[model samples]
Target: MFILDIFSLQQNIDFSLRSLTISLLLGTLLSLALKIHYQRFGMSLSNRVAFSKVFVFITLTTTLIISIVKSSIALSLGLVGALSIVRFRTPIKEPEELAYLFMCIAVGLGLGANQWLATIVATTIILIVTIRWKRSEDQSLFLSLDWEKSHNIDLDQLQNCLLKFICDCDLRRFDSRDEREEVIYYINIANSDNLLSLIQKLKTDFPQIGISFLDKTTIPGV
Candidate 1:
């Protein structure tokens, strides 16, 4: 009897198909907007285009799931149980990517709960603030360094030297298995003179090292 009570379905509310359709359409549009904003204003060094492609799908799926479950208490409990068995193993490489994903989920949840006005207003405000903040931040450049393994470069020394000329350096990739080693970095250069100084210093200190600078427009489609 208790088990039956636990599994019993509630009298579903009079759900509105028209409202669901409207929420889905709005969610789709918002997702696309989020995707574009992320691709343009995001600071992550990963593949923004590929990462953001899931936004629309995630938003719609979330909205659909929430709309279906929200009408019944039993279904909501069932959802919790169903999700308990699911495991998301894909790692998020950057915090910014995770934040964007959360925003996508928020849009879905808000619209699903029929808070369309709040969702739209909040999302717009957040995007505007994010764009302004990102624009105000320092500019960064993609830098690639390659050298023979025989050069025996010290990474710590290289980074220490980098700090003298750049505001910050983030090492994105490193490979040292072959005779040739390579490193990728996102560096913040304050001015052209600092950039020139860094280049000349690298040439003098590590003559065998190869240096390359790639702008965002040129590399990995951003």
Candidate 2:
């Protein structure tokens, strides 16, 4: 009877290679779509192009691992143990990036469980909603300025310059030192053309000024 029980357990643990292969392929394609979506619509100020490169790999690997572990309770437990030892040090700077990663994992889990149709439909719907939400939200930008103290530029002069193209400008921070000065502002402009014009005007008037625009959702940085 023990021998027969062991044979049944072994048979239960055996999974179809064709199903695993199909799941992996689907995962790869979905991950690619996610990568493209993030690169285009994502609001993260980090190096998004470099960060998004991991989507495909993360999805495919998750699919493969889930497919293997789903066949047996012992394997699933072992997987949990193995994953607990792994450490990821790279920081995720924004909540948006973390949300995308969760989406990738969810896609892999659904496909790995052989719920392909449901996964595809749900992902499509979510991506569409994300696009609409982003479009409707107010987009504010953070502007950073740095220049040498030798330029003799003052805060009032900078505000005067900003008022020409920007209808609204709020000073966020100001730092001054022996030789260098830094200023941060929260500003709203209509379009890319306005941004370019502002940058050009700043450069023309104060050649030594350094300008950087950062996404308002993130910490203001160069």
Candidate 3:
């Protein structure tokens, strides 16, 4: 009889078991969608795999927490106190990443509070806008070059070459190690049409130097 009582208590539902299950499942699936969206459209320099993986966990955890505490003020306070002991040690390197993180958290909170309609509608709008903006716009890019200082590069000639191809070509990073020099510059190249020509010119003048664009990735279909 005692064993039966314990089993029955274990099976008891708090604030509708069906609702809890549905919210968690929906939140998890939404998080997965957002992860795919970010993976395809994110322009951050930091690799996104680590941060993207956390969305599902965060959403599910938040849903479960809210499910447990939604009915009582004391439980809510206890939840807060419990959460206060936790620490977020992972460093977010980009403001964009932070923005995305907050959005994911908001989704979890909304779903946890059982505001499914609001969460779904808002997430859909924001997701579509973000993807479209990233895909249709000219994203930011920088240029970097590395070569041996012994190569005797002419700064004036290089500046003239860059000026013909790009706007606001300003040197922002300069480094030297032993015999090699590394230089980074901010450049505005609105389109890829002139990129090959610029590369050809650079190669003609400095055949042995390494030249490449920074914060650039080969995102498929972007």
Best by lDDT: 1
* Candidate 2 worst ten-residue window by lDDT: 188-197
Query: For residues 177-205, what per-residue lDDT tens digits would candidate 3 score against the true structure?
Result: 99998888877664454555788899998
State how far residue 184 of model 3 sits from its true place (Å).
Answer: 4.2
Question: Model 2, 1-222: lDDT tens per residue?
Answer: 999988887888968799999999999888999998897677654577898998998898888888888889988998989999999898877788899999999999998888999999999999999988865554478889999888888789888998798757999999999999999999876544456689899999888999999876555453
What is each predicted model's overall lDDT from 0 to 1?
Answer: 0.87, 0.85, 0.79
Root-mean-square deviation of every model: 9.5, 4.8, 7.6
At residue 151, give the lDDT of candidate 3: 93
State how far residue 86 of model 3 sits from its true place (Å): 1.9
C-alpha TM-score for every candidate = 0.65, 0.73, 0.65
User: Cα deviation of 171 in candidate 3 (Å)?
Assistant: 8.0
Q: Which candidate, 2 or 3, has the higher lDDT?
A: 2
Order candidates by TM-score, high to low: 2, 3, 1
List the candidate numbers ranked by lDDT, top first. 1, 2, 3
